[model samples]
Structures are given as structure tokens and as C-alpha cells.
Target: MIAAAWLFGVGGAILVGIGGFFRLARPALLPEDLRYLRRTPDEIDAAVPSLRGWLRLVFIVLGGYAVATGTLTIYLAATDIRNAESSAVAVLAVTGASSIGVMALVNFALHSTFRWPLSAAAALWIVATLMAVVS
Candidate 1:
């Protein structure tokens, strides 16, 4: 159970960290499947600056929050796996569920492509939360 929790927690952390990094430092890293990135090269180049510039601060803030939460889950799980504290499990579950909800909302609102990774991470975190609780 501890091993499973650790694996899921670390996997979630890595995914969230990578997402946060891309959002903060490399908006151009947006997946090609994203609706906003489906334009021609010239159009994409012309639009990337304005679009990314406009959302830069927002992305940075949200990304930072996501990274922080993900890191917190990893740290907490690593430090106290034996007890499987309820508070820690609650936080992990809440954050995981919140991430899924927020990502779904964002995808609906902006018609973006952030759902896939968010869904994946959310699933892992949810499983980790369950494992922690059971253990």
C-alpha cells in the first residue's frame, strides 16, 4: 500500500511539475492538438506571442499553485506513510478532485487540451488517496 501510494504520488508530482513548467516557461510547448494551436505556422507564430503574453501571468500563478500542491502531496506521503494520516489523505483527495474539476472547467471554457494529463494525474492521485486511507 505504501509503495503504491508512493508511486502514484511521485507520478502525480512529476506530471504536475512538467505541466507547471511548460505553462510557466514555455507556452509554445502547448500540445498541437490544442484547438488554439491548430493554425498554420505563420498564424501560430503571429498569435503565440499575443496569446501567451496575455495569459502569462495567469498561467504562472496557477502553475505555481499546482506545483506546490503536488509537491506537498509527495512530501507528506513520503514522510508519514505508516500512519496514513487522515488530514494528508483528505488534502490529497481534495486536490486531486479539484484538479480534475478545474481542468474540465478550463477545457470547457477555453476549449483547450489540458484535460488528458490532468485526468491522468487526478486518477493517480485519487488512487493514492485511497491506498493511503486503506493502509
Candidate 2:
């Protein structure tokens, strides 16, 4: 159980960290499907020049938050697993699952190209959460 938790937690953290880094430091390096630069023609026409600046800031802030959240998940799971605290483990499991689930839902609703990857991650998290609960 501990091993599984660690695997899931660390994997999630790494994936999120990479995404955040790219979004913040080299957005152009991100894959076209994953990039936030895909604005519709109407959206582009309606957007002010300053909107790009605001969007960049928003992406940076949101990316940082995502990275922090992923890091917290890893830390919480590791600490709780190390302490052999089932209750703490359960809490982290539920929290991690819900967080990822929300992200998946948001991506789906937005019709984001990243939706499939987010959905897969969310599914894995949910399974890990369930296993933690039952184990």
C-alpha cells in the first residue's frame, strides 16, 4: 500500500511539475495540443493586446498552484505512509483523488486537448485512493 501510494504520489508530482515548468518558463515549448495559445478567431479578435499579458500571468500563477498542490500530495502521502497512519493516508487519498477529478472535469468541460491525459491521471488517482481505503 505504501509503495503504491508513493508511486502514485511521486508520479503525479513529476507530471504536474513538468507541466507547470513548461507553462511558466517555456510555454512555446509545450505541445500544440497542450498549449494555451489556441484561441479561436473570434476570441483572438475580441482579445485586447494586454489580454495576452494577463493570460500569461494567469497561466504562471495557476501553474505554480498546480505544482504546489502536487508537491503537497506527495509530501502528505509520504509522511502519512511513513507514520503508518491509515486515517491520514485515507485523507490524503480522498483529497488527491478529488483534486485530480476536479481538474479532469474542468478540462473536459473546456474541451481541452489535455482532457484525455487529465482523465487518465484522475482515473489512476481514483484507483489509488480506493486501494488506500481498502488496504
Candidate 3:
């Protein structure tokens, strides 16, 4: 169970980092960005100068969240979760559902190219959830 927790955290952290880097690096982050917007970053900047900055800010916040999620998961695993505390199980479940489940849903809804990989990462969430329950 602890190993599963660590795996989920590491996988989620790596997966979440995708496109976040490109998002701030002055390029369209994902192909979905262009597919959904139908415009390049330059076009977006030309039409709405502040929009890109706002997006960057949002991604930065997401980046922070990515870090937090991984850290929190591992921290929980190293502590209360190992003892099979109900509260720890509940907390971990909530975190996984809110973060990985929601992210996977959004990617699927958007037909994001990253959807498959993100779904794989979310599978880890499910595995961890089950292990937590069985433990």
C-alpha cells in the first residue's frame, strides 16, 4: 500500500508537469490548446494580450497544486495511512478523486491527446484506493 501510494504520487507529479512547462515557455502547451482555441499563442496574444498571462498564472497555480498533491500523498502514506486509519483512507480517496479522477474526466471530455496517459495515471489512483480499502 505504501509503495502504491508512492507510485501514484510520482506518476501524478510527472504527468501533471506535462504542458505546464510549455504553457509558461511561450508556446501553446498541448495540441488541445491549439485544437480547442484554433489559434496559435501569437494569435491569442494579438487578440487579447492579457489572456496569455492569465493562462500562465492559472497553470502556475496548477503547478503548485501538482507539487502539493504529490507531497501530501507521500506524506500521508508515510504516516497515518500505514496504520489503516479510516480518516487517512478517506482523505487519500478524496485527494485522488478530486485530482486524478477529475483530471482524467476533463481530458476525456476534451479529447486531449494526453487523455490516455492521464487515464493510466488515474488507474494508479484506483489501484491505490482499492489497496487502501483492503488494507
Candidate 4:
């Protein structure tokens, strides 16, 4: 559980940093004088119609969920399970690390292409966590 918590926390932090960079900081940090060099007419047109406000809202929501998921794992580490012995902890560590790896891969892939699958990865994480809790 500790291992899972750590992996999830580190992964979530990286994701939050990425989301902040793209959704919150990048536009404001870009030089006003050099902005023209950053966009073609088509790019500018595409950007202009984008609902960035909505996108940022989504990022924030996902960020919150990531934080919660990571934190819950930390919380789990503090408790003993019903009928579980020392081996359960080791099993949890392996599962947690594996899940975090999967989550990271999904995130990396989504950054370049389809994003709907991110939700699927998140859903899997939630289901796996629930299984851990109940088992």
C-alpha cells in the first residue's frame, strides 16, 4: 500500500504539473511579442474557437480526482484488513505499482492522440482500489 501510495502520488503530481503547464501557465507565460511566431492562421483560428475555460475546468476536476485517489491509498496503508496478514501488504504494493505504470502509459498516449481512454484508465484504477479495499 505504501508503494502504491507513493507511485500514485508521484504519478499524480507529474500529471498535475503537466495539466498546469498546458492549461494554466503556458498561455500566460508565452511572450506577447513572440506570440505570432507560435501560430499559423489555421492554428490561431482553431485556438480561438476552443473553450479553454471548459478544458481547464476538466483538468482541475481530474487533478482533484488524482489527488483523492493517491491520498486514499495512503490512508489504506494505515489500516489492517480483515483476515489479511503480512502478505497482503506485499500484494498491494505490487498491484499499486503496476496500476500506476498503466496509468502513466495511458496518460502518455493520451497526450498525443485519443483522450477518452484516460477516463477508462481512471475507472480501472477506481475499480482496482475498490477491490483492494473489499478484499
Across 1-135, the per-residue lDDT of candidate 2 in tens digits comes to 776577568646855774577466744222443345576544554765565567677677777767777777777677776666787667766666566677678777667776897788777776766666667
What is the model-wide C-alpha lDDT for candidate 3? 0.70
State every prediction's TM-score relative to the real structure. 0.66, 0.73, 0.79, 0.41
Models ranked on TM-score: 3, 2, 1, 4
Identify the superior model by lDDT, candidate 1 or candidate 4.
1
Look at candidate 1 and tell me the lDDT of residue 48: 68
The per-residue C-alpha lDDT of model 1 at residue 115 equals 61
Query: In every candidate, how many clashes are there?
Result: 0, 0, 0, 0
Error of 1 at 19 (Å): 4.6
Off by over 4 Å in 3: 2-29, 40-42
- Record all residue pairs in model 3 with backbone atoms less than 3 Å apart, i.e. clashing: none
> What C-alpha lDDT, on a 0 to 100 scale, does residue 33 get in candidate 4?
16
What digit string (tens of lDDT, one per residue) describes model 3 on residues 51-127?
Answer: 76677777777766766776777677767776667787788778878887788899898888868987887888788
Worst window of 10 by summed lDDT in candidate 2: 26-35
As a whole number from 0 to 100, the lDDT of residue 28 in candidate 2 is 26
Q: Report how far off residue 26 is in candidate 3 (Å).
A: 8.7
Clashing pairs in 4: none
